[model samples]
Target: MAPTSTAEPRPSTTAYRQARDTLVALTGQHDRAVAEFRWPEVGERFSWAIDWFDQIARGNATTALWIVEEDGSELKLSFDELATRSDQVAVWLSGLGVAKGDRVLLMLGNQVELWETMLGVFKLGAVIMPTTAALGPADLRDRVERGGARVVVANAADSAKFDEVPGDYLRVCVGEADGWHAYADAYAEQPHPFETVTASTDPLLLYFTSGTTSKPKLVEHTQVSYPVGHLSTMYWIGARPGDVHLAISSPGWAKHAWSCFFAPWIAEATIFVYNYTRFDAGRLLDQIRRAGVTTFCAPPTVWRMLIQADLSGGKGDLRELLAAGEPLNPEVITQVQHAWDLTIRDGYGQTETTLQIGNIAGEPLKPGSMGRPMPGVPVALLDPLTGELADEGEIVLDLSRHPVNLMTGYLGDEERQAEAMAGGYYHTGDVAQRDSDGYITYIGRTDDVFKASDYKVSPFELESVLIEHPAVAEAAVVPAPDPTRLAVPKAYIALAPGWEPDAETAKAILAHARGHLAPYLRVRRIEFFELPKTISGKIRRVELRDREQRAFDGGQSLSQEFRDDQFPDLKA
Candidate 1:
């Protein structure tokens, strides 16, 4: 279907369309795409939800969204239906005094209303602060106070969390609830066409990033930063028109918007979602098969769990598979390829930017590498000391070109923003090594890397090797204090099913790590415990490091910890 000729706002629709078409044409050609792709120079009055989405949505009958519940209930909406429904929602919200640039705290799950509210908020030019439903009253209070939210939209079950949260913000509920505006009332309103009240540079999203070491930082993204910048992500995921893209991510994180919203919509693809209360790999795979998912993107955690389940049941219509949010272990990738004959590609990006690096489809597979710099993303490995380009160093974005994908800055924190955008480069705070082929292999976070016996040790590398053990399910490597060496590599592991935290299991895991890693990178200590993580499911290595430091300082010992030095018979 072709887009209708609607009078576009300030940005000439021609420029945006041409740039988008160029990317679509260069889907499989990685090198050319990287060289020729450019961020479109949008005019000052551009609005993506108004100019782009509504344009493509006119007269389009293709399925735009498909959501399946745990109980087998489903909700499907076509492009035209969503466009019209979002228009009504925008009108209803406008009537409730929502104006352009007003901050709205949106906290909801994977329901149809969430998507509708997002689009409506976008259409109204309101800044959306996407919050996870998992947060408690304390977190909500922090968000409302710091974000200056004028309105809050959440599910009925979560509405009571705001009882003690002092705010004058409008309380809008998804389901029926007292003292809250019902969201379903918008559906009964007459359909109204959306008009633009935003510029291309206006703030569209205020994301509270899940901080690993400190308090969560508020990352701000402009109108063009995410919606238009996700072309790189769309290309990386190989989201072609009519393809059903399924990305398993929570509602609050940037990854959700990366795949579930912008990337899929940019490709004119169907956003497929399966909502489950628990982690059931079998049921997820069954839903994928039933939905005929073609392009799939999931975090490494989900991919790891999926591999543990039966993959012998044949690959569903899944053509492209991707893993992000964290570094994917080579063992997990190898196991999936062996079962389905399809490689699980890896990609790298952050909440502060769109897809910076990714393994594009049809590209040569490099084990343990997160492929090359994404098209139009000026990526460089800068030496932390000299700020010179290096083969292995901190991953930085060359701001000389000022990539459109990057966030505006850390909101209300000018000092941190200046630090992050210093030296004419946007420091990612992560480290990597770029090989001759330009494939960037992840090292570890800058703070997570530690020195042991005068040798630099990357926790991710050790954790990757440790997870290869049969008894290990998930593992985190942190520095454990030592009498001789400053620190030694210690692994905190979560055992797989049927594996006990006994001496026998610990001995086998230690032996496996000894066989796999180099002498200097050997696991000197092992502990059986549940790994701590943020709400977004990322392992909190800083917490482990702190615990180890306190234990060493107080001359205290942790329970269930085994030391390689304790078993002198085992050779490193």
Candidate 2:
């Protein structure tokens, strides 16, 4: 069976046979799969959990989902066992007033309860609002009220987080709890598979957009966009059925669903995870080697940290490698390639979309460039001023072409949605420079771009160059206050292992930056500080920008080095 669509017919490489033939090719390794593939034109009443998983789970009583640990502990669930458990859970949840369209907030870690709740919610046709365990009381209040969540499924240990959140919503806690409803009791009920009472366009998931500058906006996705659009993601990862794919991402983020759920399941792959109280690169590599992980995906932060560890110090049968969440520094890419002999392929996407751009397997690799748009994706770079597309500008999707993977709209923000979808293009608010060779290198965010001395500066470009320096581990570039040039590029760096904060070290990094960057684009100021990151490991540049503004407002002393002021005898 192929992915089906009920909307206006559109033209693309995706058709009914695209998905079916791709599946057949992946399973059979036939050359004709590409030529015979089709993306099913699904009807308006589509439920992928019911359509795909149930059909595939029939008669497959063997292991379906596996959770392994570093201590040799593992939890394995059979296809039949999970199906029956989910059926009983759906009945029990529905009886507790969780009906179709009612939002259910889920806050858990990398445990089996997360998957069980996901299946039960999809079976009951309820909207899932995945929340990270890192969220505190205030964030929980926002999620409960503004998120329209009528029920919450969380771990018993974290149940106290909702104590300050005033609501009449139903509380279902996994594991032992004192005053909360015990979720394990649902198994006492009769097993019954659920019937879908809603269509494919129904609201199935609501994600809280990590508002870096403002309040978090609620992004809504229909039942189909994530379930079906992830086909592009599965293809990008080159994940095959039974492949043990491990993606280093936490819950509540879009990347989690991309590799952890929709994409892996669509490819019939086994989702692997290693619970860690602290991040140990060597330990993680050991788990991968011991588990025989086939497909591995992680963010740039993890990739950078991994390179600091000994590559040959560990052994793993890692076949496919992927990096996302943010633009990767070329130096990190070079180090990994030099050590592992495997290029860390770059990909581009946002919370609003799926794997729209990526460096797929069997495709050419480009340095510091995210590969061309994946299958079923149409990407165009438009000039911000002229509103006309060019080879390099802001990335936008031609919505008139009707990509099924597109989101429904931002909840309660019609004007924002209109602005986003204006002029028949959905602006991504991020800039990328595209080459004639079809490779796109990610620039800074639209707001992150600042002008210095009448010359536009991309923070990412300077930051990437800063990270190339031996003393720098992570860096973020921003414009600093300058009375003469109006503004100058400044860098906040996290030193590499065994590196220290000293005048000698800072001067060397600044000299290296001056050689790589243009005269006006050089890093005039440098500060040795830790990079602020979100729970998803993405650098919080907004925090750095705020600190820069504060320093500009008040005279403050920070470690900064400039050219022509000192240090004249360097290679540059």
Tens-place lDDT digits, model 1, residues 1-572: 33343444345466777777788788778899988988888778767887788877767878899999999899999888888999988889989999899999999999998888899999999999999999999998999998999999999999999998998998899997899999999999998777778998999999999988789999999999998889889988988877899999999989999999999998888999999989999988888898999999999988888988999887899999999999999999999999999889899999999999989888897889999998889999999988799999999998998889999999888888998999899999999999999999999999999999999999999989999988989999999999998999999999999999988788888989999899999998999999999999999999999999999999999877998877767754
Stretches off by above 4 angstroms in model 1 are 1-12
* lDDT tens per residue, model 2, 233-263: 7877888766788999899877888898888
Worst 10 residues of 2 by lDDT: 4-13
| Candidate of highest lDDT | 1
Score each candidate by Cα lDDT: 0.90, 0.78
Off by over 4 Å in 2: 1-20, 23-38, 313-315, 555-571
Q: What is the RMSD of candidate 1?
A: 1.6
